[model samples]
Target: MANTSADDLLRTARELFAVDGYQATSIGHIAEAAGLSKSAVLYHYASKEALLDAVLAPAEAGLAAVLHRFPQASDGNRAEFVEPFVDFLLAHRLEASIFINQGQSLHGIPVIDRANQLVQQLAHAVSSEFGSIADRVRFGVALGGAAYILAAQENWADPDDEPERDDEVRAALVDVVATLLTTTSTGIAATRGD
Candidate 1:
């Protein structure tokens, strides 16, 4: 029984979860995948739920870092703030797929709660910049919608299926997000004035 650290367990868990999903993946499977015993896996993560949390921690940290980088923007620099998110999604396509596909089932978990809190913070920060609750909601919704679109596009335009179109897909995502931001801002402003 080779000793493995918590970080090693978490890394293996992330890879497995990304491939098999949180619900489908098991502790034994993770341990086998990591080349450690089940007890070693349990030592790092007590349960499947905990393992899921450990797996998502890095993504949560990455998102937090991105949010911190652009807490607010009065000059309509939302694109800059959004770029990191796009990069993250594209870089971790399978993990992003797992998140988009299975996040609803795990939304009640503490890790997911923390992730939502960060999202709320992002909305609040954007609201503070815009000075309106409506703006915050609109911005948040718009960002979410853009993310959904990009995820769909990425899934449909798989690199293995359409290798030459990868650059095009990326460009389309940027254009779509920018358009969504512009439209959402305009709509928010119009509704607020009325």
Candidate 2:
């Protein structure tokens, strides 16, 4: 290909890896898909793994941004803590395929580690309103399920297109999380004289 940018290569690589499985997607395949030579792809990314990293960078950044906002978002404004994250995960469903198809393959990678850490951060954010063990467990399950379902849910359209149930899913997700937080807050108040 002529004058293909690194981002163009990353977009092509994400498509290939999403459709072809990361294990099956080779540098050559990505190059051909991008209309570039294998060497051209290599010039920008040292390896297929590096290309995968580049492709997944946005998802990582999105989660990190959400984590950054956790401290400032109050319990009552739970949507402030959850909607951006739901949107982030939904937008990056293709990247989630790597986790679906290659679980252990990415175990020790920093990206995976950071994702786990973000999950913990989410747990902490949602649980910040209540100190009870039950509330912690409940919020952890609620937030974790919200993230997982968006990332792994069945796509009802072309893989390249956004999921058709965007508003439905977003509303249901926020509703569930709000219910969890409200229930926990009410319980804490009833029990602790708040």
Candidate 3:
């Protein structure tokens, strides 16, 4: 059995899902988008859910890849963790958005379970990399906050809106993360009588 047909259908389905969203997109739309007949689309995907799962597979793989890239605790300094993690986030921004924003539709999908496992592994990696529970919590809060800000500005904001300078956003995000990490580290050290 040729995998080409299924691959084409899934690629088209992902484009449609990105543009129109899951609830609004249809099998017919994907078929037309792919320049294939509706029957051809059905033959490959069986259903929209299957297509969604196919589309999400790369994102799951990406998450696993990022988790694997996380540095180990022996490296020292929590700041070392931020750059690579942020780089991963930026490099795969679209995949991250699809996973975070559209993940609700993936309930019961096997990829969702894989993605969750990746997230758990990432959390454990963070804890180990930072070498303190406080550092892990602080890293999570700062990272989550940065993600929210970027998502809101990039995705929620109007596409026609004047694009802010990328440097400015990067500088601000770095400052915010650094400040949070510094403050948290200080507080944790103080609590430990250091």
List per-prediction Cα lDDT, in the order shown: 0.65, 0.70, 0.65
| Backbone clash count, each prediction separately | 0, 0, 0
Q: What is the C-alpha lDDT profile of model 2 across 1-194, one tens digit per residue?
A: 44447668888887777667777889999888887899998887888877877887787777778778776556566667667766766777666555434444667766665666665676666666677777876776675566556645664346886765788887887778777755675676788998
Question: Lowest-lDDT window of 10 residues in candidate 1?
Answer: 92-101
Instruction: Please provide TM-scores, in order, for all candidate models, with all chains considered together.
Output: 0.65, 0.65, 0.61
CA RMSD, predictions in order: 4.9, 5.2, 5.2
Candidate 3 lDDT, 40-82, residue by residue in tens: 8777678887777778777677667666665442335555656
Better of 1 and 2 by lDDT: 2
Error of 1 at 99 (Å): 4.8
Model 2 has an lDDT value of 0.70
Count of backbone collisions within predicted model 3: 0
Better of 2 and 3 by lDDT: 2
